[model samples]
Target: MPTPASPQRRIGVLLVNLGTPDSPQTPDVRRYLNEFLTDGRVIDMPAAVRYPLFQGLVVPLRAPKSAKIYQQLWTERGSPLLYHGLDLQKLVQEKLGKDYVVAFGMRYQNPSIEKALDELRAAAVDRIIVLPLFPQYAAASTGSVQEKVMDIVSKWWVVPSISFISTFTDDPGFIGTFVTLGKAEMAKREYDHVVFSYHGIPERHVLKGSHNNYCKLGTCCNSYNKNNRYCYRAQCYETSRQLAAGLGLAPEQYTTSFQSRLQSRLRDPWLQPYTDEVLKEMPAKGIKNVLTFSPAFVADCLETTIEVGLEFKEMFEEAGGEHWQLVPSLNSHPQWVEGVVNMIHRN
Candidate 1:
């Protein structure tokens, strides 16, 4: 008699985001900050140094202030980041159909990665595809997600085939979504210049990951290649380049910058042409009307929605700029949902 074949099993898809506090309250925000800042990849400090510093000084000192920001960020739907991730999870699940099992998790706090992986394990998935929702790869975000998943699943008695989608910055759908959003904003107002601001990482992090000390962190990032392919700053520039090209912008028409650095005198230097500094300088440069794009984020989180949209706009106008507008992020836009589905298929 012929040997029996193994039973069919669905492919598991786990989508992860950076995470948010359980609530906008100070205590909840403090707990969230404690978890987020304590990660070695994030602070890039030794346990002896990182834990005490963040848990004792940073978390306690910043919690109330950060809580106020989170409070402003909170909506009737609660955290935009969490809700958007949930919505994307449902959309991707519906599109992928019954052949795949989809789960959503945050790297830290509630709905943890361990919970998501357990759901997949219960489904007896033959293979699991881990997709960290960050379009660009960074040790602090995407890398943390990958590390957490492996640490959780390594103990499984029967491990399934596993893979990760690291970076999709150059994906047509990713670039096109921003292009569409940017174009919509530009059409509404004639701006003198455009700004592309990505979230800033400490300069040392990029230097630490520098392959054979290849990254100069200057014009070197103007071109992306194998040597600097994984460099976060380079990846940001590449995204800006692609978006600029898609929007038919010349070199002088747009500028690339970084934002949201931890404002600490003790901290190491962060990536520059800092977004705030650039925005303030624009008025003196005679660029009055400005349109900004926070391509670093896919959803309108505190960073994009408040930092770039509200805070930055106020800074621009105060510095004598006439108009400043922020392009919205790709939350549940049909095109972005389709793009994400295509990524799932392609990977």
Candidate 2:
């Protein structure tokens, strides 16, 4: 008789999202904000300056109000972002089967990245693949996730080979999912125009990452190429381009903008034409009925649900707009789950 050989080690798949507070409570929101804001990549400032500025002033002022928004955004399943991530994890796991171990984690709060990595380590995976949920590559989002993963994995005596899917800004499956969602919405009404809005980062961050000072952050982003491959603004425009083409939108039928900026006392520029400002100005231009897309987010978090879906809708209506339709994010949509599985296997 011969002893049976052990099965080969499985690969690990970790899906990471930006995260949410533990609860809608003010305390939980404050704590989450503190951890999120203090990250060096996010603040892009020295610890001395970042801590005092964020902790002393920003978090305290922002948390309670943010908590109220979170309260509105919360549902029976708790945070939509977390639950959706979990749903996607389960679907991706089922699709990958026994060959891979899948886990979900958030960058900031509960089910933290450290815990997710621990699960992969416990599974004794041979290699780990990290997929940050952000489509566009930004130092503040995907970069932070990658850096944190490295910091944790470096501590292990025997580290597994790790790879990251940095950006899927132009992936067909990702674009297709958004297109399907957009088509479904567009069928319901004849919108006057379309707007693609992405999360805004500081202009300085874009300048810092610019290759050879090529990114003026204006017309430079109108065309996407290797020179601005990792440029967040450029990638965003690229996403918009693919999505617009998919939805059968003519170039004149759509426009791009940035949203969800921080209140910078210094008036530091962030990526723009701002979403709110654009919506406000559109009615006067006779673009009253509009369709909006938030491609930067794959899930309906506070930014998508409360800010754009609810808040922006109200703003547009107040500005004399007739119909404001926000195409929902790809939250555990079948296509998106399929896309995630494809992304995992391809990487």
Candidate 3:
């Protein structure tokens, strides 16, 4: 038997998820939105442009609507995303044994990155593995978390050695986990169409991040090159392809798309076809039953629950499609929890 090391070096694993509001109330949602949207990584605009637009327009206009959606998705245990993150932390700690410490934080709101880092410091950890749960890297998601981690630790009197996993979009373990879930769902009922819908970003934002001209907002992403492979749109498409291949899905049976666009006039083109548009057109394409997955998020959130599960259901049904099922997120799934444990050790 392999014996465990004595005095095993204490290590910290910080898992970050996109944040949620403190409460479902409008005020709380407004505050959460303010912090989230104002991040330069999220909105990618100067304070002169983002602040007034957020405060004067977005907060007042969006909070109520967004709050209503949050209300529908909130549970007795609070936001699903936050609660699932907490559960994953507990499961990872159990899997890693007593030598390693695990902690979780939301990138935006309560249980902030600062608190997570402080806990790691208190544990006297010699090294830290920072894992942002965004499977696909985007300036608005994974990049924001990286920026915040550096921002917070820079002020600390003592900082531990840290490593961050920017994206695991193509991890075989991750793809395998999703394939298992997809097959289980398929067994229940074979759907006519499958949609791999990811979160959307403005076209300009993607180009600004892309180092080359390869990502021209089309099927060019179907074939990627080293220079533009890091592009968010390209990565998302590649994720869809890998997951589809893992599930043995054919090209005609599935399609890749983007969702949750805030506005139309942001000027840069976003990934397409939009989810709502797909819903309206699927019936004509003889797509009566559909399966959708939100690979962008590792845990269930307002976007996955209310937006995809509820809102998309209504749109699909209204458009004359029969069945629309959203594959549940990999929240605290045993294999997924194991994947996290493996990732921490590998890091």
Tell me the TM-score of each prediction against the true structure: 0.97, 0.97, 0.95
lDDT (CA) for every model shown?
0.91, 0.94, 0.88
RMSD, each candidate, Å? 1.5, 1.4, 2.9
How far is 249's C-alpha from truth in model 2 (Å)? Answer: 0.9
Give the lDDT of residue 243 in candidate 1: 94
Lowest lDDT block of 10, candidate 3: 263-272
TM accuracy, model 1 = 0.97
The per-candidate count of clashes, in order, stands at 0, 0, 0
Q: How many steric clashes does model 3 contain? A: 0
Best by lDDT: 2
TM-score winner, 2 or 3? 2
Q: Which has the greatest TM-score?
A: 2
Q: For model 2, how does the per-residue alpha-carbon lDDT over 1-347 read when each residue is reduced to its tens digit? A: 99999878899999999989999999999999999999999999899999999999999999999999999999999999999999999999999999999989999998999999999999999999999999999999999999999999999999999999999999988999999999999888899999999999999999999999999978998888999999999999999999999999899999899999986625898888899999999999999999999999999999998888989999999999999888999999999999999998899
Cα lDDT of model 1 by residue, 1-347, tens digit: 99999798799999999999999999999999999999999988789999988898989999999999999999999999999999999999999999899999999897889999999999998899998988888999999999999998889889999999999878898899989988998888799999999999999889988989999988888898998888999999999999999999999999999998986525578988899989999999999999999888888999999999999999999999999999999988888989988988987
